[model samples]
Target: MMNRRYVPDLPEQNALSEANFLRLEKLLGGLKNSHYDFQWFGRNNEPVQVHAEIIERFKFTSTVNLIKQNSALPKPMDRVQLTIRMYHDARMAEVVTWDSGRQLSGVYPYPNDRMYQIDEKAQANVFLGEWLAHLLRHGVAEREWTPS
Candidate 1:
């Protein structure tokens, strides 16, 4: 592996990203307003709320914000907040910012400044996929529920 070069697996990334678009749509499609609230009893039957909002919209793209509210998970996981850009034209969504952090890069130099994983971008997307799937799997849409 001395001479091996890093290459972005565009195909795999594309597939996961594309699938995430669908997952997002499934999560956000039926929302009656710009903001949506939901609840899911995950992990020890504790109530975890999810907040989703359409933060921006344009001709062929939209920005969405997702956050876990009242989560019982540990740090970072419990603080999962993301602003995703949905490319309607291309039919996929990618995380633009995580936890309000800097713009996510597709690849990072190993042992870099932030101690991030090499495939941070891809991992973000995958994390999003799992989050969305969890929302779809267990979330119950709230029409007028308030966080408590």
Candidate 2:
């Protein structure tokens, strides 16, 4: 019996990307505004900040960083960072590179280089969707977001 390796569903991945793009676009106020401070409480009830910023605009490159200012080296949660690319024409968004500075491939052969999961790209996009959802749920923008 041959082991069934995972194959990516391009349509599903694209759908996720498309949904994420709309969520992010709304979060960024139609990509007109930049900066969302996602405030959440730590175990001690201290406020923590998850900062989202539009670092670049041409084709919309953005970075979401969770580092705390004036603090020591961040913990893994605090160190989560993602470099995202937004394709307005395609109405899609993707994680171009992750905190480890590695680009996730669309599909990977089982036991392939770096031992990445076969559906890494789709997983990353799903992760991005969750992040955007969390931000939309708890984030506070510099200005109120309203449909324009």
Q: Which candidate gets the maximum lDDT versus the true structure?
A: 1
lDDT of each: 0.83, 0.68
What are the models' TM-scores? Answer: 0.88, 0.75
Which tens-of-lDDT digit does each residue in 24-92 have in candidate 2? Answer: 788766756555555655556666566666666675344433223213336565566777778878888
Determine which window of 10 residues in candidate 1 has minimal summed lDDT.
Answer: 139-148
Which segments of candidate 2 are over 4 A away from where they belong? 42-44, 59-74, 142-148
Q: Enumerate clash totals for all models, in the order shown.
A: 0, 0
lDDT of 2: 0.68
Model 1 C-alpha RMSD vs. true structure (Å) is 3.4
* Model 1, span 52-147: residue lDDT tens: 888888888989899886657776567668999999889989999988899998888888999988888888998999889988988898864222
lDDT of 2 at 39: 62
